[model samples]
Target: MTPRPLPTSPAPHRVVALLRPPQAPFPLACATEVFGDHGPAIPARYAFELCTEHPGPVRTGAGYDMVVTTGLEALERADTVLVPGWHQPPGTEAPPAVVAAIRAAHRGGARVVGLCSGAFLLAAAGLLDGRRAATHWARAAELATRFPQVRVDPAVLYVDHGDVATSAGSAAGVDLCLHLVSSDQGAAYAMRVARQLVMPPHREGCQLQYAELPTSGPVADSLAPLLEWLSGRLDQPVSVAEMAVRSQVSARTLTRRFSEQLGISPGRWLLDRRIAATRALLEETDLSVETIAGRVGLSSAVNLRRRFHEALRTTPAAYRRAFRAERAG
Candidate 1:
């Protein structure tokens, strides 16, 4: 039988997820739930499917089997190709055919994605070489050791390279998928999907997988009240001097405490919090950049843009457009 031609129009993007033996079901389900067709109230934005290398029953790590009919040929028609999680035994390389198929799909203009340990597959395919990528923090060191060419970032939730993307651990896959939806359709649609999934509309890809909370001890305990105060005053101009005064400690002592407990200097910690606040405001509200800057204590829009771009590698305007719902005429 003759195969139908792939859609040329960009709407309803085609997503082909690659499945391999011993698949981890959670990440696979994350991709499916985000890209799968919902009922008519929310129009279908993605045509999602699963494809295996050999086209048959694929074993999952969750002790179940999924029958896959499509093969690599499905990738030929995909706008995006996702690898949820590769076969376990973290060091094993993906089959040569699977690697080649992924490379071919990328070459043919599909945006390739890897979730969790699936990043090993993209690295093996040469897609992540010389590029920043993320995987489960536990396997990040091994990915770096095995590949050597990929710049592995174990801290961030995900890394998107326009043509290729990778996410850390199981749930981070949902963040990456929602990002894809926002990129392809718009933030409005992505938020709809997120609402259905009962998830935050967007999580900046750069958010730390695990926040650096202050370690417990006398010094950390003493500074807990000051930290709570700082959290509430993010919209005001704050300084290490003020913090030290509030904590009744010398500047040097406060600096030492911040470094020992939070693994960051006081100023750096404040800046990180401001940036995080800016991102939340950008995603959830329609506030102007100037207002957001003031709200986050960055003070000026110009400085906010500079710091935001320096930190996230993208401008606040672009970030807002990517995650904010568009207004109707």
Candidate 2:
């Protein structure tokens, strides 16, 4: 028998999770389960640790104290800083030390993650300012009111800005964690993790179905082939009838399938996809609106601005400026 070579492992990604008093246990578990030990079956990919501002007993709000010995300094060496859930009253501000620590970690190049109410902490750190953030829908109004600078989109399950990420309440944390895994490792490895956790492969954040930067969730279907086709033709003119032709189905049938599976009409989905493309361009490129509009099939800057404002509540130029500032910061 031929000898087999041993598998090689990659560099460990250090994930330091922040623990404030009154932590929400479920979201903490979500982060720990995903980024913590992978057991004997899977090779270790991440180093998971916990920290607090005061570095002592932490309240779980579930009737138990979690004794954490590490302090905010733990974030100094982290590749990623995750705040699972901070259970504070609506108007309360995050501790100055904690906010400063998170801000320092982010400036030091660690990606910051906030799950559920943790978004409030990131906002206090100024990470979510001028960015589209996600949180528990119930608290969305409060978050918006408290942090007027943050663009809170409560309808989405999660929103990832590459450097900073936030998720909706509860299980949505799992989705965002899995998404981070996919982005860090690969879809195949993330799929293995999801299987270990007994979840679907992945689900597109379906609230928007086609919104800008919506996190991954269940891939809608029957329209899968059509969607794949449309992705390639985003730079060209595409109509419902043309899409039906490409899918080899009647326009009515396509519309029906979209409604049944995606909960949106075909036209709406297409427009949203274009808006999404526009947003991506605004973030990544310095392309003019006229150029971007043509690239995304909007045909003109005027039409693109109208649709972009309708979808995102911000003009293309302003969105670009805000994201540029975020990147610069």
Candidate 3:
């Protein structure tokens, strides 16, 4: 009997993860866990590599140096190029050569990702100009000051604008990698990757990092119970008046409480939660768009699509397709 030929249509994805001097190990690990070579037991789809400005050893932030045999030349043919934190001090300029390499890769149609402070490099390279990007909160102000051309949204975990993407610091890098997995393969693939990494399958990048609201002067603990109630009822429309009644407080008092604690209006908080729930369902379930809409308390599929597109910059259908493709691959 003759041996069978391998399938030809689905090519492996090529990802080049750029490693700067004094690189942040966590973000690099996040990229590796998501895309690096795994044995046949793992059902791998990506050919991931770690590349540096020079084909030599690069220092890691963890006080050790690792050899990176690949150089910027690797990015020339990559489907995606990820910068996992620039590793430079806050407010410092990125090297022009590094910036040029990133720009050239992106210009050649490779997707560009800036995980954590890597966003600073992307912005410095002028790729993030007039685009929404994010960075570690501690460096957010500095990034904004240095690159006024880019819109800095420090709160969101990540922002994906097709060819260019950026994420917040630390663990948020995982979210962005998962997002890339989802985008390149599909939700199922992304979920499987997350499972292999032992991480949550889906988290709306826009979800607040901490559920705890900014606290003011001490007051009643009533808001805590109300929040718990809201959390459980995210699927249903939650009105400010209804929340006030449930908390046994006047509408005005409830509004003040939410503003003081959450730093956002109660209505905004409710919408945010609903959107987050929608994201989870979108990335985890095989439900229809209309069904997801109802489950997330949106008015209809139309409303969900509109709001989701506005918030995430891609339609639910497109997002689903990306994840599904990754999984299937």
Candidate 4:
């Protein structure tokens, strides 16, 4: 059957977020919060709507039911099509109709986006083949295992390829939506939307997931005291040798423990923590870059900028500006 032609709309853009049971509510909300009307405070740049495969009461991951009247037919009219998330049981496949509708939408010049587990559906629709995608870290391995043709980067917050995009779990979906707004309009307009939502306007898609941090338990017990001590003393110079000395283990043993417990070496873990602390200072304080560097143990603004850029793919000044704009907005 020939698909319906795209809608001729006077509205600036039409964004349709596709849902399927049991849908993930948070990602769906992320799309809506970004694209939904915010009164005159933020101009209506896009007309956002929701659609489902069967067009009835769809069960959500949160154990509630939401009635959606629109069907996959909505994809035919969308300027941008979003799949918030999909049923995530292992080895499950997207319904053929849903997959076909997504592909048809893309073919008709719609930009398609998948959030979190929704990447699986995009993969099923063959939209993600030969492209880098991002999803929740927990499901990255499964996504890769199931769709070998797709390049899945588990570390990133999101991946945007212009025609298609995918974001990591929950909050990262917000990041992706803000990115879409930025791309569609511009940084200033996107910042306005982000201000309404009380969220940071821009986070580089390449930033590593903070959720990748190690869990605490018996494995981390031996080093827990030292970890706490290090965290409180980020202003002081710290070395692996000092960490080993404090933990009463050899440097090699400390590194082994870190690898076994945290899946990273001691030095790497320390660096990550220092970087994380630096980010907090950047967001919450008005400290000069040099002062922040000294407080975070980086010693110099040049070194802090280099390490911050390496870790987040964005400069501290830019990050601070985005967050400050969010606050001012």
Candidate 5:
């Protein structure tokens, strides 16, 4: 089918999630949350639908079944095609017809998305041959090993390269959907959706899934005070020794507590908190890098950049530019 050029005029964008048998329910639900119903508070600007290769009831890994009459043909007319996580039985491949349909839709101008392991299907279709993509960190190695041509980033939540986008596991799918909403509509609309869902307005797609410092336990009795202190002193130099002193514990004891409860060291937790603060500053303020670094306890812009890149794979400037552009556009 010949696809029409994407309309430059702003309109209600259509997002179709192409599901397969035994699909990941979370990604599908995430797609629905961000695009499904806008209710009365938010203006209706998105048209979301669930489409499958063949019309009828599709089984989900979640042990339920859903009826979806829309088929692959709907994809040809879509502005965007979302492939949520796919369930490929061990040593099995996605149906070839599905792969062909995905390629045809993309070739016809619809933006293609692969959330989580759905990326495997997109990769198999040759859509991700030379582009950077991400999957669940657990599946990254397998995807890389199988599709040597695709650059797999196990660390990022998602990667957007204009026409094609790939996301990491589970909740990252939310981030990708929100991103598409932000890109197609604007940050204001995306934020409205996020607010409706009670999630962060935006998160750096590169944010780590785990803290460097592990929690010892729900020793809110002790940790609560520490967190409060840490939050208030984001600008100060915090050390394990200082934390231990304030907590009335020895450095060794505190380290043990962090390991048993948090899974990361106290120092790492502090750094992560600082990084989170830095990200907030980057998103919410126009502060200079030097100023942001000091405010986030990073001491220097150079240090902040290095840490930010290591954690997110994008520079602070690029991150801000992308988010700001999303906000404005």
Candidate 6:
């Protein structure tokens, strides 16, 4: 099959999720929410659809059934072909018919995505050869054992290679899907979609899955107030001690709270906020780097550039130019 270009038709780009039973619901839900209809306020850039190998009532492992009306033929028109979390018995290969369809679809030019254990299907299809793929951490070893040709990095959230992509389990699927939207649509638009989903700008795809995350225990209260305070003070240099004082807690206690609730020290959180502010300013304003540095509480433009590169691997000027196009489009 000759590979074609990405979808550029006047119609909305089509996203088709390929499902097999017993299907996991969370990864499917991630794709649906990110690509599904968003009402009149947001222009539809993509059309979300579903298909199955057998095309009938499929058991959702989460205790429900979804009736898929389309068969694998859906792959033919898909701008992006996605396989949501796959859950066959361990060491069991994805059905040969499904594997052939995915391989053919990719060869025919549809971008292929595997979320979570769906990487198993892509591996079976041989799309992951010579590529670093990500899957749920628990299954990483199994995937490596089965497909030594594929470099399996079980730590990252997702990996996108333009033509093919895979994500770690669960919510990381949301990150990869949003990354696609940011690529196909734009960052400004992806930000709007993120707002609708009530999620942070989907984490960077390469972010480690084992990185510290917010804790569920009620050992510490929510940090909403402190975050809000810090957001308003991004223009000023506020030390961690000052933040602790404002929170009415000792610095030691504040540090502990940050670790328990946010999985990072108060200082890291503050610096992240500054970096985020710097990005927003760079993307939205015509301000010079020196001005943006002062606004985000950095000592100099050089410091801002170094930190920006460390975070995103891009300079502020280049990012601004790139996202300016994203925003304008």
| Top TM-score hit | 4
Q: In candidate 4, what are the lDDT values of residues 1-329, reduced to their tens digit?
A: 53333323256889999988888889999999999987766667899999988889998878999999999899999999998987857756678898899999999999999999989989998999999999998889889999999999988999999999999998999999999989987887788888789897788898767553333335557989988888799888989999999999999999888888877887777788888888788889999999999998999999999998877767998878877875787
- Model 6 Cα lDDT, one tens digit per residue, 122-215: 9889999999999998788789998899999877899999999999998899999999999998787888888889887757876666422222
Worst 10 residues of 3 by lDDT: 208-217
Which model, 1 or 4, shows the larger lDDT? 4
Winner on lDDT (2 vs 5): 2
TM-score of each: 0.62, 0.62, 0.62, 0.68, 0.63, 0.62
Deviation in angstroms for 296 in model 4?
Answer: 2.4
- What's the residue-level lDDT of 252 in candidate 1? 99
What is each predicted model's overall lDDT from 0 to 1? 0.85, 0.84, 0.81, 0.87, 0.83, 0.84
Clashing pairs in 6: none
Steric clash count of candidate 3: 8
Off by over 4 Å in 3: 1-10, 90-92, 211-329
Ranking by lDDT: 4, 1, 6, 2, 5, 3
**Shift in Å, residue 127, candidate 3:** 0.8
**In candidate 5, where is summed lDDT lowest over 10 consecutive residues?**
208-217
TM-score computed on alpha carbons, candidate 6: 0.62
Model 4 / residue 88 / CA error / Å: 1.3
Once model 6 is optimally superposed onto the true structure by TM-score, how far is the C-alpha of residue 200 displaced, in angstroms?
1.3
Q: What TM-score number comes out for model 5?
A: 0.63
**CA error at residue 113 for candidate 6, angstroms:** 0.2
Across residues 161-215, which tens digit of lDDT does each residue of candidate 2 receive?
A: 8999999988888989999989988887788788889876675553332233332
The alpha-carbon deviation from the true structure for residue 327 of candidate 3, after best TM-score superposition, in angstroms, is: 28
